[model samples]
Target: MSAFVAEPTTALEIESIGNGTGLWLPPEVRDEVERVQSGTSAAELTAGVVELRNLIGGSADLFHAAMLALMCGTMVEHGAEPGAAIDATLDLLVATLNTLAEDPDEMARAASRLSIPAAMTMLARSKETRKRWRARPEIMDRLEALEDADLAPFWLREVFTLHDDAPLLVLDPNNRRAFEFRLIGVRDRLYHCYALLQDALLRHTGPGYLGAEPVDPLAVRYARNDHLTPADYRAATTLGDHQRFAFAYPGIAFMPGSGTPAELPTVDGVPLLTVSPKTIHFNWRPANMYGVIHEALGSSIDLIRELSPADAEALLSRCALP
Candidate 1:
């Protein structure tokens, strides 16, 4: 009977929830605001107050600026000095917008609490605030000229590239230089965080999936088992076979009449066999593998299961071992 070795299959289930804010706010906040704005009576104003309270309840930053604006407008109507309150509310609004801009996740969370028109209104207001900050004529010319790709010393660039999603602040020199340096120190911590995230993801996937430590060269043996004889299996398990199974030993080959096998060579003796069985060899000067390890590892078995017979056969043929 012909030997049949089943290749291990992976079931990668990726569940991507709808995290996109898509430049829109919620409808409930919008509807209530509209109802309040339409009525002119004092009772309508009271109703508007109640609606605003409900709208801004869970959001401290959003609600604070909104309520402060309404209070300032009310104070102006009652002949009170509303300038200070308006200025404070404007500052708060600007701070909130800056926080949102620096963090896409925060922006997404805030978007869910607001309506599209409200978001637009807030953005417009923020643009006005940013204009005020710009009017001071204190700009970080060096930072402005620095390209995103060119921002760093080698180590810093590597850290930043690895943790692209981390928040970065380009500080004004006039501000507390020491505090800014401290923040920069925090940015240094992100490299460790990125490594931790990678490790966690790999562990979640399983051993050998991601951040597992590289195999120790000293610990690795040339032969997988004692069953492998001296010469019989050695010929079949050449440099090519060693490279392909560097991560894990490929099964030993048996001689026709020997009825036994030889020791598999250690990866050092045959570096070329470190190649994976999934690798597709190309004839190009610099050989290319058809699919990446991540793509192969992350493919859904369910999708494969649903594939038609012809399509499945074609896929198998395309990815056939060389």
Candidate 2:
């Protein structure tokens, strides 16, 4: 959960990011540009996933810290204040990386079993507040503010994009020709976009730079409801709006829930609001959005935010990870 500010942040309408151009990559990242220019087959994609993970796995610690900002970025999409969202990121990492890499679901379930700080549980039980996995904006500003944060595949302009008008690709301009990031913007394209972004990021940068990528707007498919477990269903029903099962309660459960702003079962953790079982269900749900798309409008995350944590490791692994 980010901070549960008494007042919600104004939803800024971010029409665009990048200066009609993208951030610069060392000319060395050209291999990724070449990779994008060449198309990928399903087999290549599968193999690529395995390959990238092995590369990133080399620099685990820095990767973990860099990932912290990313983890919180989605929390904002989950309708959390920037503060609460960041706090939740730290809490989710409390379990060792081994626990997370092996079985995030089990780790989450176990964390859920821990009593939410007294205030959060009290508010949740009393129907005073609940957290929801909806989208919001201030997190972008928070992102730009992360000066000391590590570098990764993430781009603030891309993440801030809310419509088709926003810049679609973080291009590599060389030889007076633009190497664009391309993808077929289908409603259900899966998390591989993130993997590619990870590739782009870590590829030239290496795991040392948080890894980089092959080019093209890549996407993957998921098994039906693979993100939903029996535990997820139970938690969703228990904490989310019973009437709208698809509408996940994002962020921590102690805030305003998904109801309305006037609602008030809000609670904060040691420094901010914490992650709850409700949150585990949200993250486990396959609702993460790709940063780039052919058409932002009418695509999967046009109006709402979809926070995905995909990387080659996630693509290669079949485990339930958030």
Q: Please, what is the TM-score per model?
A: 0.20, 0.19
Query: What is the lDDT for 68 in model 2?
Result: 29
lDDT (CA) per prediction: 0.26, 0.26
**For residues 40-89, what per-residue lDDT tens digits would candidate 2 score against the true structure?**
45344334323322332232332222222332232233333333323343
Measured by lDDT, the strongest candidate is 1
Regions of model 2 farther than 4 Å from truth: 1-20, 59-322
Local accuracy of candidate 1 as per-residue lDDT tens digits, 1-322 = 0010011111110011133322222366445445555546545554544444343433334433343345334433333332323334444444443344445353323422232223222222232332343322122232222224232112211111121212211111111110000111111222222222223323333455322443222111111111323452353243111111112122422111111111223222311011122232111110011111110011110000123445434433333311
Error of 2 at 60 (Å): 9.2
Which candidate has the highest TM-score of all? 1
Q: Give per-candidate clash totals.
A: 15, 29
TM-score of 2: 0.19
